[model samples]
Target: MTGYVLRRVGVSLVVLLGLSFIVFLMLHTISDSPGRAVLGPKATEDAINAFNAANGYDRPVIVQYLAFLGNLLTGNLGRSYILNEDVSTLLWENAGRSAMLSLSALVLALCIAVPLGIAQAIRKNSFLDRAATSVSYLLYATPSFLIALLLIALLSQAIPLFPAEASQSSSPWAVFTDTRSMALPVLTLTITNLVVFSQYQRSSALEELGQDYIKVARAKGMPERMVITKHLLRNACIPLITLIGLQIPILLAGNLIVESVFNYPGLGLLFLNSLNREDYPVLLAYTLLGGVLTVAGNLVADILVARADRRIELTK
Candidate 1:
């Protein structure tokens, strides 16, 4: 496991390097020198040139890429051009809030999805099963932004349960104490994941139920409830580990939309604000980090699947 983890980390680093380069190239290709954007139109050409040289943007693209990789090795993520703050600091502050919201939603989703899935799987084609399937499909097919809108309309505007939009609360850990600011955003993510994960869980449970071990356990006079819990669910939930790990990107993408809709101050909101301001440093760093996180999530999923099922070989 140690060797496997080390290998995965090495590979992730390489991929992250390539990802950063690509994001750097893309940002430069689309937007001109940060100098002009910074110095404004009235600034003289010499001033702009001085700004570029001072910032190291005057170097060749490859040179800039090398510098980026070097800085990354030393744990420097460059300063935000617009905000004049360390990109890493900004990310640390905001990413924690995003992670908190995402984690809360994940917990809520699992609590609801697991039981519902097991029940549906146990019942097969019963009315309850069919209803669950229909509901899951309906939600899975709906866009997250649309879900947010519906939630705002029904829960916020009509019922006035949660605030219509989240306040710009910068306190990362405050959501745990203040349920009011978190309810709508967390609900939006929970509903979305509940729809997606329930389907996966149901299918996994059904597959596990049909396995030979389940029959053997039942034939050995194991109680029905015991068989379901001790044997069936234990095996059935393995796939869910992988599913959650692999779905990290989808979860973050959902965060983008949900945060935007709810005015939640997270990475999505930060990304939007950066785009509006044409803040190249923040934008590129965020995009690069996003790729890194996606790859890291997949690596974790692979590790988890291997750990949960010995038949799966990590080295292979």
Candidate 2:
């Protein structure tokens, strides 16, 4: 397991390096003169040249990229030209809120999905199964922003049960203390994730039920509940371990739309603002962080799958 983990980490580093270069090239391509963009449209050509030279942007692209990698190794993400703030500081301040929101939605969706999906599988062809299927379909079809809007209209404006905006307080922990404001955005992401998770759960459970071990457990006079819970549930959930790992980045991406709708103060909102302003430092740093998370999530998933199923060999 240790060897496998070390190997994965090495591979992840390579992937992140490639990702960084690609994003760097794209951002540079998008903006012909980043210094000019940072300085505004009215800035004189001489001023732009001075600014670029002062910031080392006048250097070759490969040299700039090498310098960035060196700074990254030293934990010094560059200063944001537009915001005039440290990119690392901006990330630190906003990452927590996005992490908490994504985590809350994931946990809630998993809790609901496991039971609901199991029930659907157990009561297949019944009214409960059909109803759940219909609801999942509806949720899957709707965009997250539209769902956020619908939730705001019904729960925020029409009834006023929860606040329309999620970022009511400066502290990220406020999401926990101020459930009223936090509920809508969490629910928006949760509803979208639930549809995917529940469908996977139901399918996995149904497949497990058809396995020979499940029938053997039942034939051995095991209680129906035990047969399902002890023999089936573990195996059914194996697939979801990998699914959960894959969904982490997707949830964060969903935050881009969901946070925009709810005016939530998170990485998603910061990313959008930086993109609009052409803040290259922040954009590049964010892209790096995102690549790290994607690699880490998949690695964790592989570890979890090994633990969940003893038949799987970790060293392989």
Candidate 2 wrongly placed segments (more than 4 Å)? none
lDDT of 1: 0.86
How many backbone clashes can be found in candidate 1?
0
Off by over 4 Å in 1: 41-44
lDDT of candidate 1 over 1-316, digit per residue (tens): 7777788788988887778888889999898768888777788999999999999988999999899889988989999888999989988888988888888899999999998999999999999999999998998899988988998899888998888787677887756877886888889899999997898999999999999999999999999999999998889998898888767777777888888998888888888888888888888878887787799888898788778777675444
TM-score computed on alpha carbons, candidate 1: 0.94
- Each prediction's RMSD over C-alphas, in Å, is 1.7, 1.4
lDDT score at residue 305, model 2, on the 0-100 scale: 90
**Clash pairs (backbone) in predicted model 1:** none
Which 10-residue window of candidate 1 scores lowest in summed lDDT?
307-316
What is the number of backbone collisions in each predicted candidate, taken in the order shown? Answer: 0, 0
Best candidate according to TM-score: 2
